[model samples]
Target: MPKEWFKRVYVCTKPFMFMVFLQTSYAVKNLVVKSALNKGLNHYIFAVYRNAIAALFFGPLAFFLERKVRPKMTISIFLKIMLLGLLEYVFGILYCYFKNGSEKKTLNTERIT
Candidate 1:
């Protein structure tokens, strides 16, 4: 019974565990970036290195895993994807303009401590 209960708990907690892992990773990234900047690393250079590292890690996974099951891009699907991306920024801009434009303030990024 305990073994079955453990398996159920693992399945239920998988997503929450992943969420915590991602949040922890971002926190570490921020700390490392701040430290590198303090030690004279250019932000742009750091960004390039970060992207390169990510590509190195995920590029193989994408190529191998998605090569078989990837969907073909269609014009309508492309436009829908682009629109979905723009909607977030458009709404954000409108909200910032309407909400705090007078004060020149916006919540572009939330710094969580």
Candidate 2:
């Protein structure tokens, strides 16, 4: 019974083993990224690199895996994506500026009193 149980546990398909490995690697990568952020790595640069690397890895997989069903990148779609990205960037900058500005004001008041 123990031997049968062992075989059952160990007899995973290749795709199952690959998924387990992928998830473990992703968890470890997140831990390392969090450690780097805590250590004061430049977050903007980190975000850029993270997004670029993700695109680099996933782009090919998407191209190959979904080539048959992937929707075409029309000019309208491209323009919409660009516009959305620009809006997000502008909003992020505004939010950060306001957030930091408030924090600075509080910090300065605390220092004064």
Candidate 3:
């Protein structure tokens, strides 16, 4: 029947649509950051504020949504999350270092000329 055909098409396109939406979000985020940076936003402060806002938004949802079923925090779990956060920040630092270093070079050259 046409209903079955429509259901099959919807199921097949669901993941493809989700991926397109996700990619569009990432592209938009990058575009916004690039525009802000060009307008003199400090990357370090931007990174901190971005992370802080994300935590503030998601932390409560996580705490409330999973509170009933979540396991108690153990030291090992705490340490593992800490280590993972540290690793993520380390990559952020490396990315900022290389990116800002290149930008600085261009800035210095512009000043000299």
Whole-model lDDT per candidate: 0.89, 0.85, 0.88
Off by over 4 Å in 1: 71-113
Please provide the root mean square deviation of candidate 3 (C-alpha atoms, Å): 8.4
lDDT tens digits, residue span 1-113, model 1: 99999999999999999999999999998999899999999989998999999999999989998997988899998999999999999887878767874424565654445
Reference-based lDDT, residue 51, model 2: 99
Model 3 lDDT per residue over 65-96, tens place: 99999878999999999999999988876686
User: What TM-score would every model get versus the actual structure?
Assistant: 0.62, 0.45, 0.60
**Order the candidates by lDDT, highest first — what do you get?**
1, 3, 2
Clashing pairs in 2: none
Best model per TM-score:
1
Clashing pairs in 1: none
User: Model 1 shows how many backbone clashes?
Assistant: 0
Residue 91, model 3: Cα distance from true site in angstroms = 13
Q: Tell me each candidate's RMSD, in Å, in order.
A: 8.6, 8.0, 8.4
